[model samples]
Structures are given as C-alpha cells and as structure tokens.
Target chain A: MADKVLMKGNEAIAEAAILAGCRHYFGYPITPQTEIAAYMAKRMPKIGGTFLQAESEVAAINMVYGVAGAGYRVITSSSSPGISLKSEGLSYMAGSDLPAVVVNVQGGGPGLGGIQPSQSDYFQATKGGGHGDYKMIVLAPASVQEMADLTIEGFDLADKYRMTTMILADGTMGQMMEPVELKADAVKTYEKPWAVTGTKMARKHNIINSLSLVPEELEQLNFARYERYKQIEETEARWEEFMMEDAEYCIVAFGIAARVSKNAIVAARAKGIKVGLIRPITLWPFPKKVLCDAADKCKAFISVELSMGQMIEDVELATRCKKPVVLCNRAGGMIPTPEQVLAKIEEVAGGIN
Target chain B: MEPKRVSLFAGHYGSGKTNIAVNYAFLLKKMGKEVTVADLDIVNPYFRTKDSEKELSEAGIPLISSAFANSNVDLPALPQELYSLVERQDRYAVLDIGGDDRGALALGRYVPFILEENNYEMFFVVNFYRPLTTTAEEAMEVMHEIEDACKMRFTAIINNSNIGNDTTARDVLATFEETEKLSRLSGLPVRMTTVTAQVAEDMKDVENILPMVLQEKYFDINI
Candidate 1:
C-alpha cells in the first residue's frame, strides 16, 4: 500500500533512517536540507534516538564515527561546503571500516556555492570523496522515494560490507515531494559481531582508529580494504534500464538528470528515435560490465550531467574510447528541460523535424 | 565495419541538447546497446558533457570526448581518434556540438566530408521561442545555414520547443505542427518530435505510435 504523504527528500531520509534502525544521527544545519535536521531534532529524542546538531560538518561526521565505533547504526547529512569539511572524517571512517551512512543533499560549489540542486559534486561523491585508497558506496536518488529507499539500502550495504556509504542527492531530490510507501517495520534491525566495544568477559579492547604509525601495517590494512572493495564491486553494483531493447543510442545519467533524460527518451521514441536510458543507482561499484556490453552494441552514448566535464573522464575510461560519447548538460541552478534533451538526442541519433 | 548511426546535436545555449544526448546514450547502454558520445563543444565553460562521465562510465558506457586529453583546460581541437570514429563507425556515435552557429561552423571542419559521405541525418533542433527562431521560416533559415556550413543536406527536423516545467502536451503538438510545416516546405522529413513525458502522461490524448527502439537506420525512417 502506498501512503500519499507529501514529504521532501530530506524529511523522508530522516524518517527512512529511523525506520531502518539508525538510532544515532549527528549533523549540522545546512541550507536546502535543514528540514532533515529539524525533523531529526523533533523525532530523535521522542524515539530514544541520539540526534545532535554538531558545531560543524566535521564534528557531525566525527560524531557519526564515534557512534558507529560503538557498534550502532548512525549517519550524518550535509550540503556541499559542509560535505567538504566532513571529507577528512569520511576518509577516517573508510580507513577504519566503519559502517555508517552519509547523505549529501548536493548544492552548487567548489567553495560556498549556492544552495541549489547541482550534480557538480558527481565526481567528488562518486570517486574517492576523501584522500586515500577508499571508496564510499555512492547511491544516487532521482526522487524522494529513492532518497528514502536508498538511505535504508545504504545502511544495510554499509553494514553488510563494513564500509561507509553515501546517498548522493541534489537539491532537487532533497527538496522535491512525492508519494512513497513506508517499508514494513520488521525490516530495520540487524546485529554485527565484528563491532568494537569495551573489553568484556573474554575479549580484548578493540582500537577503532585510522592511525597506522607503521608503514608496513598501513600497507597491509590498505591491501585488506582493497580486497574488500574488490568483493563489493563484484557484488554490489546496480542500475536501471528503460526501453533499451535493440536501442541504437543510450543516454547515461543518474539522480535527477536521469529522470529528465527518461522524458527525452520517451519523446524520442514517439518521433521514431530509438533511444533508451541507463541509470546508475550506485556510483561506486559502477556497473562497468553492463556499460561495456552496451558499448558493444549501441551506436552512440551520451552522458547528461550538471557539471563542466568531470564524469566525462570516467566514461572515456570505461568505454575505452571505442565510441563517441556526447555530453548534454546545464549548470548554475538551471535544470535541463526535456525539449533540450531531445535536441541533443536529435543531434546524436538522428535529426528531428 | 558496419557504419554506425551518427547524429550531430546542435541547438541554442541552454536548450538542453547536451542533456538529451547524454541520456540517449544511457538508455541505449541499459538496453544492452553499445554507444559512444562526443563532447565537441568548447565554447561553454560552465556546462558540457564532461559532467556525467563518472556516472556514465560507472554504467560501463564509453565516452569519446576531448576532456580526457586535456585536464584543467578547455578543448580547443578535436582529437584524431575521435575524427576516425566519426568517419567510420562500428558503434552508435552522437556528436554533441556547441550552441551557436559558430559552433556548427567549428564542427564543419571535422564532419563535413563524413556527413556528405555517410549521408548522415543532421537534425537542426529548434525551440520555437528561442530568440531568432520563433517561426518556422526562421527555423528553415537556420537549417540552411547549418547545411551550407556542414556541406551536407539537412535531412530532417526535431521539434524540441518547451517552456521548462510548464510545458504541456498542447504546446508540444502546436510546435510539432509548426515543425512539420517547416519540414514539408523544406522538403525534409520530420524525423522526430519531443514532448515532455509529464505532458504526455497528463493529456492522455496524444497517441505515440513509433516504437522506442533503435532499429531503423538512416534509410528506414518514414520521414
């Protein structure tokens, strides 16, 4: 059954996390997603959950680290600049193999970019968000429902893999309202055996930290983490495909860009353009093999995004330059319209008159 | 190599052509289709095809753009490898040309001979309300300019007119009519027309008959 509740992406994330057994949440107030913090502030105390509006994004993520260290489900959410401050903490969490979720309701920026929905951070979030040989299981949500669903999934995957996960959302996804059905309450709780807590009965006090003073020890830890990453890549990659049966051209996009891209695809088809859409649900553990197969058949590829040209580099690497991938995009708070997308499609696949 | 179906996307700034090209490639990849996209636009500094590379690559779709050759810089020249792909293709290739007429001229240098030899379909994307092209005649004129510069016959038209989120099915239909008129007068077929999916869903009156599959080659189009 679907509940017709109109909730923004941020509020839905908070609620979803709570339902997913995330009792600890630490975050700072940031524009475009302040509603999430406010919602958590009101709900966490009543539900006996820990909600703390930390002094800074750095503090917020560190608080998440502390809670996750205690063998509990936890999370932190922030916008672009705030996310930048939390990068150090994110690296630390990844290094220590802490299971937690980080939600970034992306705003425009390199510095304090405007509080608008922008996929500019696509690279920052999909690639190593922090400096180190680490990866965050990046999930991109195109709608509010996905924001909620992916947040819960993020937590589950993080715990399952002992890795940090990030829900990479833009302002459009964070602020938009859509109908969603709440998952059954029975789906939330899980137990972890490899958790670090105080020494009890017959155990040693586990030290959960990223500090590796010895070079050899650090190298070995990094190798171990890479092995885990390899396993994750082998199993956790996910994506969505629409109307791709015998498609000549395909559009590759994620998050909100993907939703708009679908509209273009449907339109292109009506006009006799055989196009489809390949949407990546997970940014990391990228569906590389899936795309490679597409490359083997489809005539052309297009990468729709909201940045200058960051993701294009990766697309070139993935396809090995076998085909030409076109870029269609917008920036500075402007969302790409379906008509615009159609024009680009016409440019690539065929002409539209 | 079996020649790949190649289309060159050209429209006004902020018209969303890049978005369409990118998404088209993604959909093809999802359908287990092979695709390659080229970001040939060097004019726009803020928005380009390079933004979605990471997302696309993660999906196993390949991107053929100049962004890889020069990092922290604007693309000034088309890479040789990209030219070869355009000339003879074994994969689906879409060239995302820049916004202005100057951009089309820039593409002229790289694609004129190929366009003539391949008899590729060149779609002059028009947003009716766009500054110089509110009327069908104006669109025809723009088409002429592109055809002359590219040294190829302008074969078809794509009606991509819209008013952002406010676009409706009626608006799309009206624009499609105007585009059809232009195509008829120009002796070029209307290759395709685009309407917002939201509008298509809401109106329930517009009938879309064409299959959304990439099976028809250049000669198979009804237009």
Candidate 2:
C-alpha cells in the first residue's frame, strides 16, 4: 500500500493529475471547485509545472486545447457556470480529437444557481454540453479517494481514446475530506501519434484543427468518432452493485446521491426490505447492462439523484420499461436524507410483491 | 467527580480540530453531562460543527452556531444565545474555535465573561502535517498568534498531528517528541495526543492519548 493522506476531493483531484504526469493546468476560479485551481497554483510551482489562472473559463479551456494539441497532459476545472463558458472550446477540442481532462465540480445551475453541491449538470455533462455531437468520457466519483483515482484514470482514458474526459463531481464531494493513496510514478503508456509537435525535417507535418471544408470529410470524421464512442460504451461502462443479489427493489444513483442511497439501502434492509443500490461510476456509458440485469431480478427501481430526475430517463431507457422506475430526489442544491430515500424504497417495495 | 465544564478547541486550518471537538462533545454527553457545543467558527462555512446539527441534536447536545452557518453566505452572524451558555455554570460546553488568528478573534468578545465566570481550559490543537506548523517553533508561533488575537491564553497543547485519513499509530507517536519541544517553548503542558479511534486501540501504552471518533462527512458508498 502507498502512503495514504487525508485530502479534500478537489485538492486530491489536482494532486492526482500531477501524479499522472499532467504538467500543465489552466483554469478559472469558481466556488466549490476553486480548491483545484488553488492547489495547482501552490504545488505546480514547486514541482516545475505550469499553472496559469486564465482570464476566463473560455481562455482556460482554449489553453488546454493548445497544450493538449502539443501532446502534453493538461487539465482544467470549473463549476457549472464556468463550464458553460468553456463548452465551445470543449467542442473544438473534441472536433480536433485533442486529449485533455476537464473537471466539472458540479453546482446548482441553469444560471449562477448556487455554490452548494448539486447533480443538475447531468444533461450538460453526459449528453454533450458543447455544440457538436461529441460525448465526453464522464467519470462520476462518489468519494475523495475516487476523486484522485478517477482523475488519473480520466487522463489515461482521454489519451487512450483521443477524446476529452471529464470528472463530474459535486460540491459536497469537493469539500469533503477522506484518506487517499496516490498513484506512484509510472512510465507513460499511451502514445500521441497525432500530436502537433514541431515537425522535424524527417517527418510529415501534423495539422491540428477542427475545420474540414468538405461536408463529406466532416461526415466521415463524425462516423469515425461514433465508432470510437461505440467501443467506449461497450468496454468502459463501469458501476457498483450493493446488496443486489436477492433484491426486490433497486435504487439507482451516482456521486453524492449514491452515498445517501447506500445508507438508505442499509436502513431498508434492516427493516426486512430487500433494497439494493446500483451506483454508476461512469455516467457517460450509463452502465445500462448492469441496470438491465438488476431489472430482471428487481421488481421496481428508484432513481435517486441530487437533480430533478435527469438520470431517471437513462434508467427508464436501460430497463426498457420492464420494471417501474421512480424518482427520489432533491434538486437546486438540496440533498435527500437517508430517511427520505428509505421511505421511497419502502413505498416502491410495497407495490413490488 | 465532576467533569470539566468549559473546554475550548483551537487549531489551524485542516488541523482536525472540528473532528476532535465533535468527538469530545460526544464523549462528555456519553458521560451523562449536560453538554452544549458552541460553534464559534466564523471562518470556514463548510465542515464546521453546525454541519453535524442532526447528530449533535440527536445526541442531546445543543449546537449553538451562527445564523448564516453551513450556507453559501460568509457573514459572521454569531448568535446572541451563545453568551447564555457562558453564563450557565451547570452544563459542560465545548467551544469549537475556527482556524488561525483571524478565526480566534471571534472568541475575544467572550474572553472577559469566560475568565470571570468559570474555570476554562483553552486547548491549542497542533497537527505536524499541516502547513506553517510543521515544526515545534512554527507551532508555537501559531499558538502565540491565537492567544494574542483571542485576548486569552491556551492552558495546554493538544498534539493532533495526523495526515487526515492516512494517519496511523506511528504517525501519532512520532509527534510526541515535537510536542514535548512545543511544550517547553510555550510553557504549556502537553495535555493529550489524539488519534483516530481505529488507531487508538493499538496505541494503548502511549500516555495522555485521547482517541477521537472520526466525524468527517466522507459518506462512503459501500458498494
């Protein structure tokens, strides 16, 4: 076991990125997520890395695009509103197939909603917040440990697929502290053959841009990207099933909401109700197969979220309407209590058998 | 024997003071004392004693915090009811002070009343792993800074040296030597060395050890 240190989620993510050999960080300050930038600012200088507080999220994400195109590991983090400003740049990065890690420490939103934790950015994150029809490999971490682990994984996945990867966490997870063991120094694995490093006299020049004048060429590019997405969906869909073996009802949640639902499942189980939890660690791939498998055994499902039932749509789609799916949630920065979730589980279980 | 009535826990940021304070409150309450945890933290809005309102309340310990606590607002809205706790000589009170000199200034307002009314022990909690207080001299500097800001003196030093969740018995034992150095420099006795409860059972031979139940809201998903 490596040396474990108690770390806040945001700070842990930043340090993990550094440990993952991400030498360049560019980001704007936003609440609940400012710790990432602050940690980068303090440690990056000592470690001989570049940490720039960009003028805006737009400028910061564009800086990521530039660094990533040059074949360097780079990262940028923001809250909901700040992420909104970076969408265009994110789309540009995806269109150009540049590998970069973007962290969305989610907060309540439609506008500058609140600084408290919320899962309201589900649609914006997994469903392509940017303009193009591109999907980010969205990893939702429920703990401070996962915050560090997934950040390292996010960089690797980004480089593996040549696409932008996101660590979608909320304010609760960002502020919360837990013990985390950081990854030790390792050799770099993925090769960036398409990187726009300075063209030496021996090799052909590499062009990095999102522009293709011909519509046919752009259509072919989209099809190729979709093929990569298909591969990702097939292989990278990850989730955790708790007490799901003999469950009559299943609770679907992710991130902070999953933590609450786990408690609710325990409480429900104590009362002789066979409630289980399916926590999706990877939100983009949706973990549909596991949910479908649980749907076969469980008579009912409840989608517990910090948002107003955004992930429930995915749950319904995954189950194919085979079982009744209900929403047990708190929106606009409110978190559901274990008792509230337990009541929902009991209510759904009442209709099960 | 009667329990200690007024205990103040002060520390630097990320020093694990809040977790110690919460655990101490539970300890006192479990001993059948009338306990009240006053949230004197005006610096950090998140991870304060007020965030454990439900637990504290259910444990029969009243939590006295600012009105705007645990919210996005950063205003220091200290409640007038906190002064009444100072007047009550019957109950055991734990003052969970905020981080650093800036946070200690809030305690200055009640210094005269606390000094006049009751027997109090203001504990300066020190974590060796935290920045700025990595050494004994550096830890003494912070202790003096808090004393100057609060217009009161810390009676003793509490060695709360741990690197968050990664702390072990060895980590707690390693700080004992530095804390002795800190004791000599500050002319204050090392009251107790605190470690998480998980590590405490193995470190039984260590003197002046206070095992604290972890109160941090990591909220693990056991899946």
Q: In model 1, how large is the Cα lDDT of residue A137?
A: 94
Candidate 1 accuracy as lDDT: 0.73
| Tens digits of lDDT, candidate 2, A64-121 | 9999999999999999999999999999999999999999988887788877789999
lDDT of 1 by residue, A105-195 (tens): 8777777767666888878887876898889899998877788888889888988888889998987777555445557453555576657
Clashing pairs in 2: none
At residue A260, give the lDDT of candidate 1.
83
Model 2: lDDT of residue B220: 48
In DockQ, how does model 2 score against the reference complex? 0.31
lDDT of 2 by residue, B46-81 (tens): 778877888899999899999888776647678998
What's the distance in Å from true for residue B147, model 1? 66
